[model samples]
Target: MRNQVVSRDEWLKARVALLEEEKELTRRSDAVALRRQELPWVRIDKAYRFDTDEGAASLGDLFRGRSQLIVYHFMFGPDFTAGCPSCSAIADGFNGFAIHLAHHDVMLWAVSRAPLAKLEAYKRRMGWTFPWASSFGSDFNADFSASITEKQQREGGFEYNYRPAAPLTSRAAAGPVAEYAATTGADAATYMRERPGMSAFALEDGAVYHTYSSYSRGLDGLWGMYQWLDRAPKGRNEQGLWWRRHDEYERA
Candidate 1:
């Protein structure tokens, strides 16, 4: 058997080619980042409010004594009886990341328009202290298109709120229908009729800001990973499928 050896010139030429390609990629990334600075800033209209365990608060209050606030408008709307499983999966992650986010000028908290009691109860059930706030009795959630109002729904916004029946199966998608701005047993019917969430507002020098109400699927990049895995040849990601609700583990 004969072994094939490459010359040093061949190796260096290939390495330099790879280096130039990497440099081109870096240049493109830098150009894209410069555009981020030029993206237009929109001033929020209307007053957004939240009900915290401590009491009623505006968007600024969400800062939790910080300058920048990042609110995860979790899916569990006020009416639904339960929180979203996938979103809860997300909350599971944030339950750990919140500690680190607070270290910076950023305060990351989960926001749902659900009643304060309901939000608190769910937080306990999940064993998460990731700091959730309520937007019950407010239009903040609706304005941001998370939930809908009676007027909006009557005008045909019902499609925007949770529709449990929209799913092809009950067990799989029911959890999502109950998320924020979503209705429960009866609330889903009247979700658009009431203010539901987004209750109050704050005043700055001369403007009113919608205190950071949230939306799901984009808050975390978790949605992107799912989209990519769907195209993967493996069919399923075992690492992401271990959440067995404690029943499957015992059966096995």
Candidate 2:
């Protein structure tokens, strides 16, 4: 990128050095994953329900016959005409891999607060086959820290990513937040009500337990495109929110 040229021996020497650091990071990542799986789980007692294409379904029903479930808290509030473009970008990576995960006993679903009809229409528009369910008229999103009310945003009593997030007014309002809000056909206030996150659940003995939930930047690993970009020569050379839904890419 800097237009610098190096001898083959020098490049090979540098690459081998970097390989050792990469291997060390991989070992550290494996240990952290083990620790995550060892964390305590909480039994879910609330009878949360979701509206899916299959009709009304309970939390247990979301497992769809699998022992494990991973719910992607997509940002699509009740007022939005469409799903969030950024979230849609992430969902683009799901359709293919979700089937393989299902075969391995993990069920994945995208959960949003939007009505089932809206989610269904957008899913069709995006041509994503992965299951999606609506938490409309249910406390599922609120309970999972994926949706907040105007009162909470104004008065301050919510936590995301295991810590209290800064009040809504403090959020940088000029760039992606505003742009994506407009894309969803909702005002900034209404759009900000929905946040992105993912929750993991396990069913054992007919009871579902909350295994894990991640929010904010904690979801970096789940962005499959970013995972690939991080390994590219330029390495995710991002400047602001420069992504869109797959279909929305301009034709050259």
- List TM-score per model, in order: 0.59, 0.96
| Per-model tally of clashing residue pairs | 17, 0
Q: Which residue segments of model 1 deviate by more than 4 Å?
A: 1-37, 150-252
lDDT of each: 0.57, 0.91
Global CA lDDT computed for model 1: 0.57
Tens digit of lDDT per residue, candidate 2, span 1-252?
654579999999989999999999999999999988998999999999899999999999999899999999999999999999879988988988999999999999999999999999999999999999999999999999999899888877898777886667846555778887998999888888898999999999999999999998988998888899988888898898888878777841
> How well does model 2 score by local distance difference test?
0.91
Tens digit of per-residue lDDT, candidate 1, span 16-121: 9988988998898799757744554445655668889788887777777765556665666656676654456556667666789789666777777779998898
Mark the 10 consecutive residues where model 1 has the least summed lDDT. Answer: 192-201
Clashes of 1: 17
